[model samples]
Target: MLQARTICATVALAGVVLAAGAVPAAAATAAPARAAVTCPTGWGSGAKSDSDSTATPLSDIRTGRHDCFDRMVVDVPGAASGDLGYSVRYVDRLYQDGSGRHIPVAGGAVLEVRVAAPSYAPETGEPTYPARAGHPLPGVNLTGYRTFRDARFAGSFEGETQVGLGVRARLPFRVLELPGRLVVDVAHTWTAGG
Candidate 1:
């Protein structure tokens, strides 16, 4: 009888434990669910954000690669340089910034990056980032980037300088002016990690 009572108690304990477990399982299933976080499309134009012109001139142009996008940074000296605004967009054809002559680039799409700061020194009329004969800026190397095909210095007019980027296709691009630098990020595709 004692053995039988022990077995009955064990069975009752197991039943209570199972009932407790089921309550939590049902509660978990009834809980609300959340959707995955999705990023916005990279292609589009940003509102024109202007700033006071700077004497701190653009000193260098550099490019790098990321998992999702290609980056181009225009190095400047100080706040004056960062405050300089920019206009970046997809264009049908890249023309010389000042003269408007047609410039034939190497890709199916062209991104025109026009900066409010010049790449030259103001006092002596010398270039901070000297223009290369056949290349875009003085020391840009686009050897391995998948989306970037060609880039060129598209001249400076008034208080702005232009840089033409030849890309694989008409993808999205963004221009950001920070203190001492102007940055351009080009998406590799319409979807992330493409």
Candidate 2:
């Protein structure tokens, strides 16, 4: 009877150990939970603009995704060369600058990004940025972005080039002028972790 009781106790101990080991294995296989996103404040959705103009040519346009916002960078001559003037405003509809025709943009809201610089070389008038009106901007892919849905070239006429940004909603956004880039960041949520 003593031997039988010892065997039963050992079996129970082994069962407990096996169960404990299974728990860790199961936990290791489970996917990790993503952390909540915290966003910045004071970036309103109304309109952000700078009147400073640049003689430097518009060279490129690019996009990126962040934890709290989606970013659009407009490449141009460095600030050392000249300051870049930009007008970024939310609009009901986007229109081509030179032709005044409607430019189709995909999203719940549109931001008309107007850079106060030409898309062509000033001296030779040769095109520097090949984005055309009423079409998707070259090399810009908005896949899997939380705030940005699409980007379309509105037009480039005179000294300014316009591009339309389509976002999920009229979220808060801010624009910054860096050394050789104009950065536009649109928030993913209204408040922190929202």
Off by over 4 Å in 2: 1-36
Clashing pairs in 2: 52-85
- Please report the candidate that would top TM-score against the real structure: 2
What's model 1's TM-score? Answer: 0.71
* TM-score of each model, paired residue for residue: 0.71, 0.81
lDDT (tens digit, per residue) of candidate 2 on 74-101: 9986554238888999999998886889
RMSD for each model, in Å, please?
Answer: 8.1, 4.4
lDDT of 1 by residue, 87-133 (tens): 77778888885577777777888888777777777777787778742
Clashing pairs in 1: none
What lDDT does each candidate get? 0.76, 0.89
Weakest 10 consecutive residues of candidate 1 by summed lDDT: 39-48
Weakest lDDT window of 10 consecutive positions for candidate 2: 76-85
